[model samples]
Target chain A: MLDKDIKKNESADNFVLRLFVAGASANSARAISNIRSICELYLKNRYELEIVDVYQQPLLAQQEQLIALPLLIKKNPLPERRMFGDMSDLKKVLKGLGINEVI
Target chain B: MDYSAKNKSKLNVLPKTPTGISGLDDITRGGLPQGRPTLICGGAGSGKTLMSLEFIINGATKYNEPGVFMAFEEKTEELILNVASLGFDLASLIKSKKVSLDYVYVDRNDMEETGQFDLDGVFIRLGYAIDQIGAKRVVLDTIENLFSDLTNESIVRAELRRLFQWLKDKGVTAIITGEKGDKLLTRRGLEEYVSDCVIFLDHRIVNQISTRLLRVVKYRGSTHGTNEYPFLIDSDGISVLPVTSLHMDDVATSERISTGITSLDSMLGGKGFFRGSSILISGTAGTGKTNIAATFASSICDRGEKCIYFSFEESANQIVRNMRSIGLDLQKHIDAGLLEICATRPTMFGLEMHLVDMHKKVTEIKPDAVIIDPITNLVTVGSVNDVKSMLIRLIDFLQRGQITVLFTALTINKSVAEQTYEAISSLVDAWLLLRDIEFNGERNRGVYLMKSRGMKHSNQIREFIITDNGLDLVDVYLGPDGVLTGSAREAQILKEHTGDVLKGYQKTRKDREILRKKKILEATILTLKAEFESVEEELNRTYTEELLTRNILEKNRKEITNIRGTSSENNTEENGPHIET
Candidate 1:
């Protein structure tokens, strides 16, 4: 993933990341914690994470157009990736983010 | 106007505060702008204070917008308690920090002695309260209470401008209530020009119906609803539902209810009446218009929906008793909170004021069906046009809430139930005509569905009897006399009697024909019997005579041998010839 990031950077591609978080409450705090953990384990230096707090920033939340809570976005990866609900499955989240190749 | 940043750009998309009023919000496109000062100007008891109080309380409770109310009339505590009767928890909301109410008193004696007053005290109090609560909404009820006297027009005018500017500069959405005067929007009229928005509250009597009309005269920098909305205040506070007008969308309901007569329902295309429609029942006195209205009201309640009956002629108790005699158990509904009876005379107050009070009462109860027993009594205070307009306004007020309304009107002329001198027919969604027809030497009460918008109803006039159990819609009277005038049942009996007599006469004629056929068969048998007897006798006599003749011939032969055998032979031949002749 890091090698791919280096190649993408060399190509001078702009990274666009997005994350839809339902209202900023305690439930969101726990979801954000799990999202950060997944980011560090699978795509440490490969993708940029866009954390969006729907509460306090409702318009931005609407712009991302999310219906559910605690969404994680990996915009830098040519195709955007989204994982909802605390990112419980590390393997699926990594595969969805396009970082790890699973057998 | 300031579009320099994305954050500021997003603010433009927010929907305005819709006060949930009847016609007013349609005029203002929801309600006043969110963080701007809206001046409500009206005359005394014109509902300026009531409007502001209702807006503030309703916003804090309904729209999730916490508000602060600063009153210049009455003590804060008294206002709280008074509004509490209408189901507004002002005191509790204040304790919860959802709403804060403060009263600033202005005394004429104090101002007269001082001779000098500044707007600083008001500014300080309002600023402290708004910041303390971080209030997004605020109401300053009745600016008239702030002034000791309006003798100096120049000072009052200047002060009004400064006050409006301060409210705008503070960036808090405020409603400044004021007293309306004949010359200007307010006594000073200065606040009308300076405020970002101006709303006028009116209370008037037209057609015996007292109504409150709220109109926004000015709204800067925004598209607003431009119709006069009818507002109601009750135990639940204030709600303004936009009335149906010629231009807006009015969704028609396909559901219906029976006129309690199958034949009548058939005339209406098998459907009964539209849901959430207004029906007007008009007839002369003794035509049973009220009875029909009561039955409908009861039927709706029986369907598990709530109904409200406003009787301007009878007392609540009297109406209940009268309806009971006609077989409707309205008392049970009243006990269950399904039916509310409000009986008041239109003459109790001026017409406009009466409408305002009625609006308030209806809002508090929130019934699914409303019955105004007879609007004619309200005409005692107004002209025909006034009554017509008042009814239009009232219908507009309730129908917007998706509430079904049944109204009764007394016909001044006994001839026509569908009134033409009054042009309210077009305003109603449906009409029911109850009439007394004089036929077969009796007067019978019959109800016919005149029109039911968007649904079918019984077009046939149904003869309904007020039985001990209530209004019994009998089978469509199909007798030769047609729908029996209330007493036409007697004519039916008389016709039955004549039919029976004719049947008896036909039976007697059939019996006589059978007797005559029996007599003719007996005469033919007697003649045949006599002929049979004579034939038998002749056969016997012939046998005997032959025997005797034979014996005499034997003797005569012996004598003939001596006398003449030819004499005996001649006698036998003569007997044969005589028979042939």
Candidate 2:
């Protein structure tokens, strides 16, 4: 399974991510910092991140059907994935974003 | 602040919001706790979604309060389409800003949780919708889906708790639905948070019949009905039946309504039945129970009042046609809008559904009288106790509405009939038992007034007859043999009439014979008297002759009376006279 994931990762495209959060909540700030650092360390220059505050853009939250704050969605991956919570666990975030191996 | 103080000064009771669903308000004593979240838990297909939807819709349309509905399982379009079948115009309400629908899609496979989080996104979305419509009521249908979507149970629980508190702070009366758990009220124990009010719905199938029930498990700071009330989901949405008001203080009226049979009315203390009273007519099959019920119904309509007939055994047209044979024109009343006939098979619904349907009909029609043709047919769908309970509630409801009702029960036999009568007889104000009196190789109908609560009623069984003209009661003939009915009664009457004629003829003959005898005897006496007179005259003549002879011999005894004496004297004088001659 690791060899297959390595082969798929070799041909994978740029990572497109969108993080939905409330305005300056402690959890949202932690999730934003954690995901940015993880992306910069793992897939630098190969990932694009967009952050949306649900309080400012409630229509976006409604359209995206956001339930939990600090929600992150990987839009570019062939199989899109969503993660809830403040991304405190690096290993779990990497696994959820399908980063099986660290560059 | 002044209003709050006034409310507090009155009874110190918690103010409640009215949920316009039928009978639900009565059960909750008013409605759900105002400005608090009420947890509604039920199993699949137990009408949780529909109930909450109705709450929101009723609040929006009836109370002039806008509402927000957040569905977790179904999307907004699906919700609108689904409730459209129940006669709810969700789209129009949404367009008019009276209702706002938000569908929250929760898929476990699409989401992953990395660390701690709160449900602020849901709060913002819900808050936005509520603010958009200024909604006073909110519904979260099956929020248990979040438990499945999110893996961390503790976080979800904490977030849900906060969300409930936030909703309370928003001052909106909220209903949160949850799926039934194995042993708990809800799968995720949502009741632990929304503690102000908890309602449980159940759908069960007993003996091949399905029934839905609603129970108010708990209502903090207020008293509510603790019984499991049966509810129904028809085209008009869910309606709960709060069976049996514990109070027996229904007002009684002295107004009497006719039974449409004069003799029958005469048997019932010269009146038929008390208004707002329940009457039971129990009889065997083909004993004309329906005929009696139809007669009463038509009589109600004849007074320019309304009547609703619930027929379980036959269709409306069939009842009308059959009643026409006995001269009851039910169709005319139906055409005049004074009568309505509802026909359905007994097996179509469970006993409680029938009851709820009946309550709905009574509320809708507001009829003066209601007739259930052959309530015994309900026994096929439920136990005797179930039917009895249903009927008790029905009678209570109708009586409370001040509507008279008539029930026809088919009694299979004597013992069973007595059992049924004993079960229902106590609940009814009047009971008329129709029996088939089999005698002289014929079967005749006899109606007995088993009981009439508040008035004088005849105890004697009347000979019930149904003819082309209408129904009537004949006084049961008491003859030498026994109580006679049918051909036996007619035969006895005929014999008595013949005997009277014969006795009259004999009396006249004897009178004429006595007159003839008296005339003959008087004639004989007259003839005899005449004879006597003649004889007396002859004697006198003879006496006179004798006297004359004697007188010739002796100086004449001239008179007859003195002849004897004179003759004796004249004997000598007559000799002397003769010698002188």
Write candidate 1's Cα lDDT for B473-519 as tens digits: 55445676455555456557677888888888888877777676676
> Which candidate ranks first by TM-score, i.e. highest?
2
Interface C-alpha RMSD per candidate, 1 decimal: 27.7, 0.8
- Chain B superposition TM-score per model: 0.73, 0.88
Instruction: Please give each candidate's TM-score.
Output: 0.64, 0.87
Candidates in order have lDDT scores of 0.67, 0.89
User: Can you list the residue pairs that collide in candidate 2?
Assistant: B551-B556, B553-B574, B554-B573, B554-B574, B555-B574
- Can you write out model 1's per-residue Cα lDDT over A1-103, one digit (the tens) per residue? 5446445554323433455555444446665666677666655664455566555454343234332345555555455455544455556555655554653
Which stretch of 10 consecutive residues in model 1 chain B shows the poorest summed lDDT?
Answer: B108-117
Chain A TM-score, each candidate: 0.67, 0.84
The all-Cα superposition gives candidate 2 an RMSD in Å to the true structure of 7.2
